[model samples]
Target: MAGPPQQAEGSGSAQASGSSTARKTFELNNDVQVADPSDSLFAYSRDEERVLEDAAPWKKDPHYFHTVKISAVALIKMVTHARSGGAYEIMGVMYGKVRDGVFWIMDAAALPVQGTETRVNAGNEAFEYMVNFQTANNEVGKDEMLRGWYHSHPGYGCWLSGIDVNTQMTNQSFNDPYLAVVIDPNRTVSAGKVEIGAFRTFPEGYEAPQTSQYQSIPMDKIEDFGVHANSYYPLKVEIYKTRLDEQLLDLLWNKYWVATLSQSLISSNRAYATSQLADLGAKLHSAPLDASAKLKKKDEGVEDDATPLNQATQDSVRINTELQNGMTAQVIKEKLFNGKLDAEGARKAVLGVL
Candidate 1:
């Protein structure tokens, strides 16, 4: 996936170089296809911005990347594409220039890769697509280089998984300034903000700092979330826009507001809701509810000072509280959106003359 980083990376060049006879059948003015005959190297450029070819300051700093600035268009495209995936994961790549500690993301596009709910690894086919898409952009007069990848976590919130961290690690291990981005489409819908995170891996063997999680994650996905939480750190993300972008966003919101007001959270994420409840049931069934669930020795029991909260009890309360907040938000949305519908027959009767 594109920047902020949590998707598999692979080169598709070898697979793309097919027989000339096969290539003859598909060549067109629009250069993108199932494969590239030449298997051309991607145009990794630093053309638009001021060059720092000699200075390699980032290699020395632990927190080299302080911010990631995504174009307004890129942000919208990523969010909409992530939302379209529903429960399944989706992946894409970003085109930009990484200057100093900031990643100036000019654009983003989805890769032609099939992703399951938990995994999104770009295969050879995706590499081909990446090359073709980059080529097409150049033809159309847009020439930003591939800066990073982004993938969705669906309902699990925007944090890199173990897989994501590994993928990002492999990517950056070979290539400096590459980034990883994760998006949570379901949380975006519920929370009224694009739930996105940008990350860069530490140099190998470098220990890192870590997150007060931005949103709720499914229990099934939390372990991966926790395991790799410190392998990389997040960047401050900001969205940038020009005059045309401002107009485009205004037009989008004009059309989007209706859907925003009408959407039901539970309907949008029924699978997540069911999965959360199922996980809670399983967790409760297997884990002790409290210290009372186990027999205590007389010496252990009478430690009279109010027993400080244990880790297990604190976790259960947090999970329960977050789930309640989610459901409560859903109920509130339903009531708010159906305000007119809840009115008695007098309002309906008044309209009958039409």
Candidate 2:
């Protein structure tokens, strides 16, 4: 667990370090694994004019982020409508590529809320809600595609905050290469324009940035999301498999299902569709084209059962040598990959030495 906040501030500067300004660390739970090694950081952008058109009625604010994959969101019914601000949760998936990065996101059913305080961000629901969405992504499948997250900052320019850092670090403990996105709804100076900022932690330590660079990303370039030429706020993320290539389609499925699973697990307790996993497994097994190939790809390295762990279970594996009573990162990793140890067990074993 992380120590309590050293101090509090409306916003604090992140001391950036090697490679990037953002820094993070992830402590994986038994149900998930890092999706991409190359994606050690995150990024996002926005089309101001597009947002202006879509959020016209409510004058909505929007933000975007990157994760293990896109997600599924339930169209939240508005109990009491708010003219401006409220809160909401994002639902999405986590996916792993054969040799690349992971993607995270929310799906069609997602919606904004009117009021509520969440456990995340010191009672700030926004960031914590997103974190839960990511957790859901993991429970679904390992093949989800990352499309990034979207939400609106209260007002002013887009930037990361102290609470955002806390949330990001929480995510980092799960995996590196996650992104933080902030949307500013008060950029009235440009009316039809919106400002967005993307950030990622440095791979090593918390250092400062030399200077900031904001990159503009094409809406369509975001894997499965795109913009309508005539509109801004009401953009669309294509869900039909026929609209994408094989890799992109896989990305869509992984992103969508991960979000679905994540939300289901968190909201209900896997009671709704307990057999969803088995159904997916069956689909992979029975696909007419290359059932064997799919089965091999899907089942390879899969563990049908999980063993929970505690400190003693971890210490039990220690084989004293010239090193010590415990093991090194290498030894622990080797044991994990070789099935000699579980992820949690290995982590505890290593913590023993530290």
- TM-scores of the candidates in the order shown: 0.68, 0.28
Best by lDDT: 1
lDDT of each: 0.70, 0.31
Off by over 4 Å in 2: 1-150, 175-177, 188-190, 203-209, 212-354
Judge candidate 1 at residue 237 and give its lDDT.
91
Query: Candidate 1 at residue 203, lDDT?
Result: 79
The residue-level lDDT of candidate 1 at 271 comes to 70
Candidate 2 overall Cα lDDT vs. reference? 0.31
TM-score between model 2 and native: 0.28
- Each prediction's RMSD over C-alphas, in Å, is 15.9, 23.8
Candidate 2 lDDT, tens digit per residue, 161-245?
3444555555544543344444443331122233444444432243333342222221122121111111111122211111223
lDDT at 201 for candidate 1? 83
What TM-score quantifies how close candidate 1 is to the native fold?
0.68
